[model samples]
Target: MGRLDKLPPYLFSAIDQAKAAALAKGVDVVDLGIGDPDRPTPASLVEVMAAAVADPAFHRYPAQRGTPRLRQAIAAWLKRRHHTVVDPNTQVLVLIGSKEGLGHLPTTCVEEGDNVLVPDLGYPVYGQATLLAGGEPRVFSLAAERGFLPDFAELEKLADEKTRMIFLNYPNNPTGAVADEEFWKRMIAFTTKHNIRLVNDAAYLEVVPGGEAALSLLQVASPSKDRVIELHSLSKMFNMTGWRIAFAVGHPELVGDLGRVKESMDSGVFNAVQETATYALGEAFEGLLAEVMDVYPKRRQVINAALAKMGVEVFPSPATFYVWAKVPTEESSIEFCGRALEEIGTVITPGLGFGTGGDGWFRISLTASDESIAEGARRLEGWK
Candidate 1:
C-alpha cells in the first residue's frame, strides 16, 4: 500500500467517527451538528429548475464561466443587495461551490514557500487549501477575548515577506463572531502595508441572526481597488448546498486568474441549476427567499435558550446557522464531543476541529426544529 509522508490533522473526522459510532448503534441522534441548512430551497427556484431541465440543452457542457444569463444575474444581485459593483465578464466567476473557489484561489496566486495569513480557528479549508497550493499556512489567533475576530498583534508576530494572501471570513463559523466596518478598514490598511492580497469569503452574508450587516473587504478604504476578491455561495441563502453553485466578485484581475484555473479544472455547472439561480435573482428575491432566511434565527434562539437552561455558556451568533457553546467543567473539546454524542445522541461539531483557538469549546448548530431543540435541551439535563 502507498502512503503519504505527512498530512494535516483531520479535525472533523474524529468528531465524525464518534458520531458515526453512536449512529450505527441506533441511538436517537439529535443532529445539531453540521452547519448545513435543514430547510428546503425556494419554490420559485425549484419551479425554474424543473422548467429549465425540459430544454435538454442544459445537459450539455456549460461555459466554464457559467452562462452569461447567470453571470449577469449574479452581478445584478451583487449590485442590488450588496451595493457593490462588479463587471460580469471579467469580475464574476462561477464555481462548483465557494469551497472549491476558495480552495483553488491560493494555487492561482501563491508561489511555493509563500506564506498565507489565516485565522487559527477560521474555516479549516483556508489552511487546507494553502497546504495543497504548496504554501505555508500562518494562523492568526482569534481568542474569545478578541471577540473571536483576528487579533493584529498575533498577525504581526506571524507576518513575513513571504506572505502573499490573507483569508478572511466575517460572521465567522464555529464562533458566530463578526467584525465591524472599522475592522474592515483596519484590515485593509494592514494588508496594504504588508502587500498581502485579501480573500474574503462572504458565504454567510445573508444568514445573520438579526439581519445586522456583514462587513465586506470590497467596502474597505485605501487599498488599490480590486486588491480583494470576494466570494458568495447560494447554499445558505437559497438552500442550494448540494447544487454546487456560487460566484466570486471583485478585482477583475484576480477574478480572471481564478477563471483561468477553473477552465483547466472542470467543464462547468449544471445548466438548469444556473438557469434557476438566474431566474431567482432576476425577480429580486421576492418573498420566496425571504421566508427561507427567517427559519434559522428562530432555531438559533431555541438552541441558545436550551444551552442557557442546561448551564451551557453561549452567546447569540451574529450570523450563520451555528451556535458556539461552551461546555462547562474541565473536559477537553474532543472528549466533550464524544460524551455528548454517546449520551444524548446529539452530535455537535467539536471546536478543536477548527484549530488551536477552539480548544475546550463545542459548537452546536440550530439545524433542528424547536421541538428537537427542546428535546436536546431536556436530554442535556442529564449531562454533567
Candidate 2:
C-alpha cells in the first residue's frame, strides 16, 4: 500500500464528528479530549514577540540551525533547569515546533526497509513519521503493569541490524508516565550497544507539579558521546502551543542531520518567534513556567477525586496535564469514550486511539478550563 493508504484513520476526526452531532442536538459538550492548554501564553512572552515582529532584521528567512542567541539560550536553559549541558553551536537546532522536528527526524537516519522501534502507546507522529520516511516502525509494548515503560527484554528481541532509531516520550502523553535517571542510563546503554539512535520527545518534561523535576534523557546520556537527541517544546512549558517554537538538543551529528533535512523540506522557524523563545528561556523562564504549571495540579486533583468517587483507577503520576484512567466497565476504550459523549455529553479520548496497546483505557486531558473541568467532573461522578 502507498504510505497515505497505510496510515490509520485520524482518530480525532471521529471524536469531532460525535462532538459536532451532540452540539447540534443542543447537548452541552464538555471537551476533555485533546491536550492543548487552554491557558494563554505569558503576557511577557507575547510582548517580546510583538516587539520582535516589528524588527526588520527578522524579516528575511531565519537561520536554519537557529540564531546563535536562541541556541545559546536553549543550552543555558537546559543547564539551569535540568543540569544538562550541551554545545549551543553544535548540539542545538531550532524547530518550527517539536512536532516538526519529530516528523523530520526519521528521514535523517532511516532508509527504505529500515525499522524504527516506537512505543506502542505514544504520540502517533513517531510511527507515522517513520512510515513516511519509507521505514518500518516496530512496536514495543508499554504495559500498565510496567508503569507504561518499555520492557528492555522486548526491546532486545525486536531490534536487529536494520533498527535505526527508538522514540520515547516522558512525561508520556495520555499515560503521564515519567522516566527517571536510572531508566535513562539503561536506555543509553541499550541504544549504544545496538548502535541505534535514541530520541526522547521531552515535550512535557517541565510539566511536573510534584515539587520534583522530571528527568531528561540527556541528563544521563551524553549528547556529545552518545547517539541521543531530545526534543523540548515551549508549547507546554510556556503555553506557546500556537507559537510553534521548540528546539532539539543532543548529539552534534544528529542535530546537524535533522538540520540538513530541514534545509530542503522547509525554512526555519520565524526569527521573531525564535527571539521570543530566546527571551522566554532567559531570565523570565522560572516565573513564567511557574505561572503556566500552577493550574495543572489543582485540575489534576479535581479529576482524581472525581474518578475516585466513581471507583475508576487512575494511573498515578504528578506529571503532565492528563489523567490516564482504566475503563471501569468491560467495554473497550472506544465504546466507553463514545458512551461518555452520548450519555454524559463529555468527551474523553479513547486509549485505542493511541494504539491497540492502549485498548482498555481512556485519557482525560487537564488542559480544559477550570469551569469545564468542574462540570466534566460533576457529570462523570453523576454518570457513575
Clash tally, candidates in order: 0, 0
The parts of candidate 1 lying over 4 Å away from their true place are: 1-5, 209-213, 221-224, 284-286
The sequence of per-residue lDDT tens digits that candidate 1 reaches over residues 89-168 is 88888888899899889988888779899888888888888887888888888889778878788777888899999998
Query: Which pairs clash in model 1?
Result: none
Considering every candidate listed, which one attains the maximal TM-score? Answer: 2
Which one is best on lDDT?
Answer: 2
Q: Candidate 2 local accuracy as lDDT? A: 0.93
TM-score of structure candidate 2: 0.98
TM-scores, in order shown? 0.94, 0.98
Candidate 2 residue-wise lDDT, 1-384, digit = tens: 898877878888999999999999999999999799998998998899899999999999888889999999999989988899899999999998999999999999999999999998989999999999999999999999999999999999999999999999988998999998888899989999999999999999998874467888888888899999999999988888998999999999999999999999888889999999999989988788888899999999999999999999999998899999999999999999999999999999999989999989999999999999999999999995
Q: What value does the lDDT take at residue 303 in candidate 2?
A: 91
